[model samples]
Target: MNNTVVVAIPATTANMGPGFDCLGMSLSLYNEIHMSLTPGFINIEIEGEGAEDIARDERNIVFCAAKRVFTEIGESCVGLSIKLINQIPASRGLGSSASAIVGGLVAANKLTGSRLSQERLLDLATEMEGHPDNVAPALLGGIIVSVFQEGKVHYLRVSPPEGLNAVVAIPEFHLSTHSAREVLPKQVSMKDAVFNLSRSALLVAALCQNRLEMLRVAGTDALHQPYRTKLIPGMNEVIEGALQAGALNVTLSGAGPTVIALTDGEKPAVNDAMKGAFQRAGVSCQVKNLKPTVEGARII
Candidate 1:
């Protein structure tokens, strides 16, 4: 048997339009975590993404997640060196933390003799991440629709349509998930609730069948984006620019400092337009032309 386990987990964009906490999809970018048993200690090393900002000690999220697994299974957590090769940007609303949680759990489970099934691993990952939207795709991959009900996760995975590309504009700043949620109203009007429900349903169905035309209407969200965009400067212009550049739909990726546009292969043009919009607004950003990935977290 292999003495080391490496888990490659994808980055995810959650809350796609009106789906709120229930919808998410995986991107091509990934974060990899490697683990090997040691004599008797816990050590964590990180590279890339949050290397300087993330903790190297037990306070690290990856270390904490791996430690949680041992505690959950009644085993002491020690004797492991976990290394994270992080690619997903932290606190950019791109599921960086979700990748870490899934990676840690999968690494621990693989080293512990695979005691949990994939579904169970997903549940554990969801528990650690506080929601299923991001972790669901990070662990299971593809476009995932998930709901946590009565302590169980129910989900459906859809393969992103062929010929579709994602143009992502990622800004340098960070947006805390807690801070983003803080601005949201505790109670929404019935009209707003119904608006979200219909849009969320349409977004899911249209994404599954590759109905590009439906996305324009389906992605009109009333739940979070309206409130969250207040935290993102020049957000409206960026969305309009992507639409003018031929994107089917543009939405905030997760709680967002990053925004993504769904396009029918005009990836580069859409990417440029988004960045230009931000630049015109005096904000600096990086852009990526990415495709959806079907593969989830796996040991290699």
Candidate 2:
């Protein structure tokens, strides 16, 4: 088998509305990676995102993931050279890290003669990520609803409907996932739990059935967003403006510092309004219009 392995993984948005650590969807953005074996030495190269800040040594998540795969199979690898062509922004609530973990595992699996099945790979990825929301969708693509219980992941993938689009407003600042989760309450009331449950079910049904009206109610979350709002300035205003500008619903993308608005035909207006809201709040951000996808990680 050829030692050279190349893979492409997509960017994703997690915790869409009320799904909160359960729902995630893959976006059009992608990161391409190439890996090869070397002897007694390692070389790391990157083209975009976290080039200077990301670990260049064995501590890197990509390298760790690849190493983990080898360890799991009791195989010995001399060294590794990783080339990453990254497009997803780091710490932007856009699933950049998830893609990296997936890229490494997939490349190592291919180089090792595909010893592990995709299901096993998924479990490994989720374990590395500490949650299945982001990695599950990054591995399988599409709109994913996942439940992680007893070290196993149960998931359903749904294709996004036509004319249903997303506008992502990414702020200039970065909020690490650790910091974002720290702001969350240690425990939530049952009322909030039930609230999120009902909306999560609605969200999955609405996105699959193309019921735009349901999104407004389906996206509101009392479990996390309400508490996390304090971490993001002008959060409510941005959500309100997007809805007024014709977006069906607006919510924080993953943690905070980036906001996403769900739209149908008013993508441009919603984009403008989201940007304008951030601008009015004295925050600088970049906006992008992206379509959800059905593709996942694979070697080409």
Candidate 3:
């Protein structure tokens, strides 16, 4: 087995409206990690995204994930060297942490003869990430509907429709996932629960059946988006503007300061509308049109 490996993990968007902690889709954007085993030393080099904020030593999430692989497989690595080229923005709901965790696990597994199976890797990733929503797609790619059940992650991957694309309006500020979760109430009303359940199920069906027009209904949420809107200035305007500009659906991307719109039409118009709405609401943001990618993490 090779002692070094390069893994490219795609950025993922979770929730996709009403699926809350269950649905996610991988985007074309990626973060690449070049990892190698070294004796008696650990080093990490980060370029792009959270270069200044991300830890560079053993405490780094990449290193911690790689170490988990070695521990799980009963192998020993004296040290590790990790180089990250981050294309996905950090803490803006783009699955940056999931990419790092998946990249580290994949790269280290390769370096150590790949003792762990993909299922095992998924389980490990879920353990680290606290949920399978983002990590499932980051590891397996495409659209993933996952749940943590009976101490394991059960997931199904749905192939994105031929023309489906995402327009993401990313705010300049960061919103931590912790902060977002804190805003959520401990127990939602049964009416809201049923509301999300129907929409989440509809989202899954729409993706599976290639029913693009149904996405607008599927993207409506009654769970987290309503409460978290205060955390993201102009969230409602961004969603409304994107939809008005012909996007099929729009929602907060993961625990977002980023809003993503799914569109098979007028992507540029949707992009401009999302940006303009944020600007009108006194928020500065950047927009990117990213395609859905079926490919996940892999050695390169």
Candidate 4:
């Protein structure tokens, strides 16, 4: 068997606009993990953005996924060393943990002679991720609509329309998904729930028909965003700026301080407007133009 395997998984933006935990798209940004079997104890390495203080041992997600796979198969092996080169920001709603989980599982699957099929790998990834939206798109690429039903995951892929670019405006602050969810109201008004459901359906229809104009209305959310916005200062300003600058739509980029705007023209204009809004609102932000990934996770 080959002693080493390297896997690359793309960053994902989930809950695009109004889909909540049901929609996601993969971005070009990636996290790469390399695994090699060695003699002694397990080891892990980290690099790039959030690596400065990340754990370098079994406590890491990569190591945890690898160990889960090994234990599941009842296989005992020599020590494993994992090198993680992360381009995705941690806890920024960019699927950083999803990438790690998928990358590690892919590495282990390859090293163990392909014990799992792609579907099986995805199931494992979804299990580790606690949600299918981000993991599905990260593992399969493109735009995905997913629902977890009766212990099974069902998903469909949709191609992004031409001239559509993802403008990610990342704020300097961090908002953990757990903390964000905690801030949401447990019960919503009937009117708000119906409003979100209607818009979410419209958003799906727009994506299906590649109707960029419809997104302006489709992206409206009454379920999560209204409640979550308080935790994300300047959220409304950024969205308004992106729309005013002619973006097709703008929404929370996950449970985020990072807002993603879908643009029909050159991304720079939208990015500039978004950054300016953040600045005017006294929040520091970085902007990046990301193309959708057609390819998902792959072994190298």
Query: RMSD, each candidate, Å?
Result: 1.1, 1.2, 0.8, 1.4
**TM-scores for candidates 1 onward, in order:** 0.97, 0.97, 0.98, 0.96
Q: Which prediction has more favorable lDDT, 1 or 3?
A: 3
Worst 10 residues of 3 by lDDT: 262-271
The most accurate candidate by lDDT is: 3
Error of 3 at 108 (Å): 0.3
Candidate 3 per-residue lDDT over residues 67-180, each given as its tens digit: 999999897868988999999999999999999999999999999998899999999999999999999999999999998986699988899999888999999999999999
Using TM-score, give the best candidate's number: 3
* Residue pairs in collision within model 1: 38-79, 41-79
Clashes by residue pair, model 3: none
Rank list by TM-score:
3, 1, 2, 4
Candidate 4 wrongly placed segments (more than 4 Å): none
Q: lDDT (0-100) at residue 45 of candidate 2?
A: 91
Task: Please write out the lDDT profile of model 1 over residues 118-183, one tens digit for every residue.
Answer: 888888888878889999998888999998977779999999888878888999899999999998
Can you list the residue pairs that collide in candidate 4? none
107-143, model 2: which lDDT tens digit per residue?
9999988999888888899999999889988889899
Ranking by lDDT: 3, 2, 1, 4
TM accuracy, model 3: 0.98
Off by over 4 Å in 3: none
Question: How does residue 255 of candidate 3 score in lDDT?
Answer: 91
